[model samples]
Target: MAMVFADPEMLDRLAKSLDSKAGAIPQLKSRASALDAGDHVSGLPAIASWLGDTAKDLRRRANILRSPSESPFDSLAAFGLPPGVAGDPDAGKKFQTELKAILEAQKNGTPQQRAQAVKDYFATLSPAQQAALAATDPLLVGNLDGVPVNVRYAANRITIQTEYTKEAAYLATLKPTDGAYKRTQERVDTLRSFLNPRIKSYEDPKTGQDMKIEVSRQFLVFDPHFGSTADAKSSPFPDGRIAEVVGDLENADNVAFRVPGITNRLDNFNGFTNGGYQLAADPNGNERPDSAVVSWLGYDTPELGDSVDPAKAFAGGAALNAFRQGISVNLKPNAGLDIFAHSYGTLVTSKALQAGLTNVDNVTFMGSPGLGPNINSVADFKMPNTKFFAMRAPGDWVSYTQGHGKDPADFKDITRLGTDGASGHSQYYDPSTGSLANMRRIFYGGDAKPLTFTHTSLDDEQIGAAEAREMVGFLHSKVPPEIVVKMGGDLDAAVQAHFAGRTGVKDLLLEVHSVLGKYNMLDRVPPDEMFGKINDLAGNVAYKQTYKAVKDKGAPDFVAAAAGKAAELASEKLLGAVTWPVVKLLEVDRIANDAKQFGEIIDRGTAEIGGHVRELGTELGREGAQIYNDTKELSEGLFKDGGKVVLELGDTVIRPWNAGQNAADIWKIGDDAKDKIFAKVPDIAGGLNDVKNTVVDKGGDIARSAAETGGKALDKGIDIGKGVVKFFGG
Candidate 1:
């Protein structure tokens, strides 16, 4: 019933303070009832709200203070009937009379007087009336009527009591526990064996331990509709195909399982003709003696390159769903599993993970065409601790030309796949060579050393190597040597330097030409043609230029005479060369000073020539003897200690490379034109000899005089620059 608050201001303040706008009207009524009954201070609106409708919802939900036999509020917020109404409108007069009685108790009374008045009013009701009143007003049955008129003022009269049930109360209750569930599972497993039987176990010949054991609940070859096999007695799935695989898994632990792609077989519950176990076998029937492998032919699909039927989609999902359901139910606490999915099997693995069915440690995709369009985040897949790895070999046709929708990383975002230059489609199992080492790192985890391939095939050793490499990756091993060599400091610098020097070789050839011509050795070519040949040869030295030889366009007699003067120039140059022969003297001094250095230079140069010969893929012919004789004659002459004849031979053979380049360009000009170029080599060396001996024999007097004169002339040139600057004074 609505109990109006006597103080409007107090009601307003209590409503604002509690932030309970919905409960404000009811709270005001509760405050008025308490004050009218002389049970609380009317002035304390905040405290009244706590004991009013605001608290009603809280108390109903707790049900702590409710009598065991009475109904609590319908909802936490339910309270008494509205103000101005009771059980019926005709009873308003009766409600008013009752209200006045409660209001009259607060005035002119002791604490005991008010308390007794409240108790006597409640005591007036008969047991039947009390029962009816209790249903409508639960607070009345709990002695709430006689809360002391001065209860807020009396510490001694106020009483509080509580009751608690003992351990026996909750002990009778029920909930599930791990122990019971596991025990129940044990019973179910025992019962399953009666229906399904062990089909086979792959044993290791060396260790004699069953690596992968298979079992089927039924041995029936079901129809495409999953109906009974023609031979009911010999079906693969006795209880069910999925159930038998679940039994095998529950019994053993494995590092990884290979799920093979499509192969047609009917009535074999697991699609026997093409399955995981069959695919893992060495194609040539060679056993992988080093490791255990299983080709999982569990996936259902049409043969490779065959179009998919709409009806089979549901079957595919169902088969995967069955395996997932079984694995989830029987997951061992400590064991982790790896799955190798090749080709169409990748699709199955992808679905299983996406559906949250399989709990796998790592998943590898080999020879995969596609997974899905987008698998960007970890949340996109269903399993935990799952690693997605794939490999494509160099010779794999698919790798060479399969259309990539975008850049590899972007394609990964779109297709949810990953590929590296080293990891793209290729051989994943042939350890003899190729990407198997890299795949091994992704799977088994191990170190990769020098791997040599004799034949291209993905065999057991290669598979073992790839798995081992994957194992090493798991262990965080060091990278391979080839990677180190390509990326490291010393080798990188050497490669750069070697290439740069090669580019400069042609320039050095041109520099030798200028030095030869400075000694009046212009007989190297007919004067008119020398300039044209220089430009022609320079073109051939680099791709930026194309060399074209000038034909014999009828040379003038003067040009022919210049070309024919080679012998005269060689003789005249020899007179000067003989007077100053320090090049010959120094050669003698070096050969006498150190025989070991001489031997090493000769050995190293020969080795360098040998390597170049091998690279050109050439063979020595009859002309080889001429080259050997030229080399021996030159070496013997240069090796001598101070002989004029040897010195002369050494100079002719060691002509400037630039002059030789010019000579080569013009050698086809004519017979006399070629001889003049050959004759210029000795002319240049003989001229240097004339000057060397002139200074040597005279105790360096002539050289000293010339140096002093040159210094004076250079000083005079500096004075001239200063004079010119002053003459133009600003």
Candidate 2:
């Protein structure tokens, strides 16, 4: 939790410590250096000696035991008096007075009060302090030329290692060394540890095995210019030629996809050969057979400061499509796929979904400023059914500086790249603490311990949850196959409808299909059982047809009424199957407002197909009656066997979807019987025409209904494809 500032007196006490003096440099000539004279180890002693004497430096510097070599600023050149408060005089006086009081409160304040006092001091310094601090630390400030830029941390202003000793001297003069200064010094160390990056190993309580994690060292290439492929035949691949690391074929269970951001060319591809292989190599120095990571450095864009050009189609999407095609050539279905995207790589994720590639599971984003507002939820950014993860350390300044005035939904915001948003743009390693734990948890489940400074721990569960939601959610990206088939069917309809001037219907179908396809009925389902269920259902249909036909024949005015009733029943049955899922899916909305709005859409689709099927059946039955009557007049023998007569009449008067094939050609049939039926029906044009129309109409209805229903479920599962082009169509 962040500290709040309300107390003025407490802030004054803290102000006293802000102007403390630096301690004298240690006398290294008197003590023996702790090195064995080797070049690598020779400098260690002198560095250690300087760290021992910096306790009296400015509050920020004193807290850090800096070695001379590691000293960010040269002592003589960088040291300066605390400049008089530069902004508002009245506010400065109030804060200065409050700062001293806060120092006293540190000795006698409640935890809450003490926390508030800390907040007050930081609040007064905020934008100005941040700028000043960044001005001094080379890591934080890109270029120093009169003006200072405030490098933001996670909602806090980090202290810059400056050369001001007056701030250090003033604090030492007011309070004893062991009093407030000591405690504040300890807190400063804690803050540093929280922000520092480190690789650590810990014993897992669950597996009781030592687990190791390294906070990745982030490499920021400041504008390594890469021109278009058309202009340059070969772009420089950065770092070096990458090693094969873990071969794609070796990872039977894992598949990795890498996305390089703007101005990427050869340099971005190093992860595939070097960084990826290094990570894939086991501690014993062998390649793991279950995983492989691939780098995708195929994209084009303007420089960092430029806005994304809307007119141009980004190359990453097409590259991913090509990659998917190549991968499918050898990879088994359903392998877990992880996608790593950095900076502009996030925009590639959006395009991947727009294209037809599937089976993505995880996506991770790093060094991104913000993801656009259109991507309000993780679902909006991922493939129909993929998990997404986002990682950023506090030290990375791009997350804050990039896209400052742009809309939250603009692609300029990299955080939106995750299924769940990654909040800040940060260096992956600086401030070895905080969000690093979240990134580790995404790759290897469970908490990573926060780096401890002298007095505090920096990382916590809240940040962990945000990271987990983004990463783990990415793992769930691939919707189950059954759901996909259904969604795909509906998507096909949407595409067809869109081109045919049925945009409204297309929109509805898209919505419905997306949600319905997500329903996972596999918990206890066996693939082999589907046929058996269909068989049982078919038998029930046959029994009802026979029983109703007989009962209707014995009743008054049975002929016309019987056919009408049967047509209505078929429509009801078809509609019921399709409509039920829609209603049920919509009910999820009532339980939670965020529930996907696809149910009603699927139901409407069911109705359309159901009504079509019923109308076709009715029309066929009417035509069948006319054929039976006309044929009977030609020859009484035609009506002799009622079953044969009915079959003949149905074939001639009904036209069905995919009904051109003879009975023998459709389902399994006896060769002898198949021959006899075909010979007897030779030149029986009317019967064949009738059945073909009926079958075609019914088949279309079923395909449409299934597509609508399945698509909706899948959309719900992945939370994508809602309104499609409509949302951004213009």
Candidate 3:
């Protein structure tokens, strides 16, 4: 037994390494960006192209060892329960007669029908007998795919809970230093995941606003995923928690199953689920989208350094078994199904399809490393009627990680769709991109228009000014499915009226004050209105503060400090020139994007606002970041109290926040790298993130087309096969 835990520090390091690698890949041999030259793609000579490819390959090879995943199983004890454990020792003996009878009856039907017949057989058993089996032999009933959802949920609860109880009791008898403690802790961790799955909150990549969704731990595969072997200690990590679902799998007419890449865990499943929720959500107008999604982190995921290992995919067959079973049991006859994957996940997905993932209509890959070694093209997937689709963001670096196999985008056998959000390898699901829309159209019938340019021009190649606007708009839309879906409507009139006053006697606030005004939005609104607005915004933020003193203060000192400063910026002579246009530009935006721009314009178009403009910009960027952190701590906790459904504009609390904030800071610094090392990081790092409308993300713009028709639960494996995982929604 082992106490398996993902070291947060190690994970953070891995993300940083990959992020650096992502930056280096696009920057290979040149200080200028790839899109800087209009002739880089189509105008290039054949030799130059080959050199570029060769150079990229060399770069990937050099960095290939950058992040190999560490599997705890390698250092832990061998598989199988410890001595004297009773894991239904009588399971086989007791099931022999019933199994034989059921098989005899199941012999005549098609695989699908035979599976259903087994469900029928279980249904025929008296409730008491079924309960007895669930109590003593749940592995048999709970694991079989063809079993009814109700039966599976019931049996799994018993099997999982009973195993947990037994393990817990045993754990109590052992010392903390016991050899069994670690493994038991690992076991208990897996079991507890099933019992108390996590909630993932993220800023929607497409919209750039915070969203929340719960990752439901549906199935619990507690045994060894690699099966019996002489090198048992080196076997793949046993599949553990958890998996999340979106949509109604048992009742939905269409479903999709998603296999994840690196850094996936039961704890982080919500990030993907959030993408699915957005993907399946009803478009702004008349259509009601009906679909389901399942995000599966069902296997021991390969992390940083070991991400390219074949075992990860080779062992994916068991994860496939779970998905196949999910499809087998809950699927309505003739309903549609699709399989989706990304990066290393493509290996798992392809291997599963090649092995025998029947009835899946399409197998798709986004930012794929490649298909596994044996599989070469769409032709390699043997499932009848299965079409293959591929999408790749223009700058994504995963195309270089070929140890897993060849870039699927190069295969002529498959249909290719251009990516909207593929600014980075993992950004395919961003709502700002067309990638998610493309995939949704591919998986669900829809009309989507993905960007088809092949690097000839860099207009939409990376997240740019337009992308930022869309992201901001996505956040502030304040409408259904845009970041935080709220038809919550306008702020209360009474509340609005109460805080409607302007400040005239404000003091002289300088550099940092000017910057903080924009962060707290002091510079955006009317100079006279800055104080009242800041105080009101602070009051709203204060509502969520957990500390009684801060709560009593209404808006911590930060609010008053921010407000007081903004009031002073109104009359400050140095900034007086550009203040109006800056306010106008920012009034419509949430994030403080134009602080630096206005500062430059102030110098160029008006007076010398002095060298401190950059200083003020950096301070704005830094304060913006801190304000985000402070409020997120409050906003995230406020959900339980029903105070605020989601925080307002300029909230950068997601993983990508650092990148966003850094980008802002970089914009301010403009080339002033001598000042602070932290402020210079984004200029050195890669794109914001590998964030896609990930899981069933909305990136392809795939989801946008085809007249777009329609649109969770731990209860029934939480809609596992729907391929819809959660994103925040009411």
Which candidate number would show the highest TM-score if scored against the true structure? 3
State the lDDT at 297 in candidate 1: 36
User: Judged by TM-score relative to the true structure, which candidate is superior, 1 or 2?
Assistant: 2
Q: Is candidate 2 or candidate 3 better by TM-score?
A: 3
Please list the C-alpha lDDT of all candidates, in the order they appear. 0.36, 0.40, 0.49
| Candidate 1 ranges with C-alpha deviation above 4 Å | 1-248, 266-296, 304-318, 328-331, 376-384, 395-730
How well does model 2 score by local distance difference test? 0.40
Candidate 3: residue 10 Cα off by (Å): 27
Span of 10 residues, lowest total lDDT, candidate 1: 155-164
Model 1 gets an lDDT of 0.36
Cα lDDT of model 1 by residue, 155-263, tens digit: 1101010101211122223133422233223223332222222334345788966554433222111112232222222222122111112213332333345554433
Error of 2 at 147 (Å): 55
Error of 3 at 572 (Å): 52
Q: How far is candidate 2 from the true structure (C-alpha RMSD, Å)?
A: 32.9
For candidate 2, lDDT tens digit of each residue in 32-123?
33444354445645655444343223334323322112232221112231322222234334434554466576756433344345444545
C-alpha lDDT of residue 56 in model 1: 55
lDDT of 3 by residue, 1-730 (tens): 0111233344445555545555454344353444475345432344455555555554553342222221211101111112122234453345436855776776765555656667676677654444444445556655555665544544555455565566666667867655445545655555544444334444466785656554333442323232222111221133344444555567776777777786554334445545565455433311123566666566666644355456767687556754575446567777688878877788888777666666688778887877865677777776558877777776665653344566787686777777744577777766645677666776676555442423322223432322333333333332223211111111122221222221122322232244334343322233334433333434433332223344356867777566655544543533434454454443433223343444443344223222234444554566556555544544444443332212211243454556566556544443333333344334323211222112123222233221121110121122221112211101
lDDT assessment of candidate 3: 0.49
Q: Is candidate 1 or candidate 3 better by lDDT?
A: 3
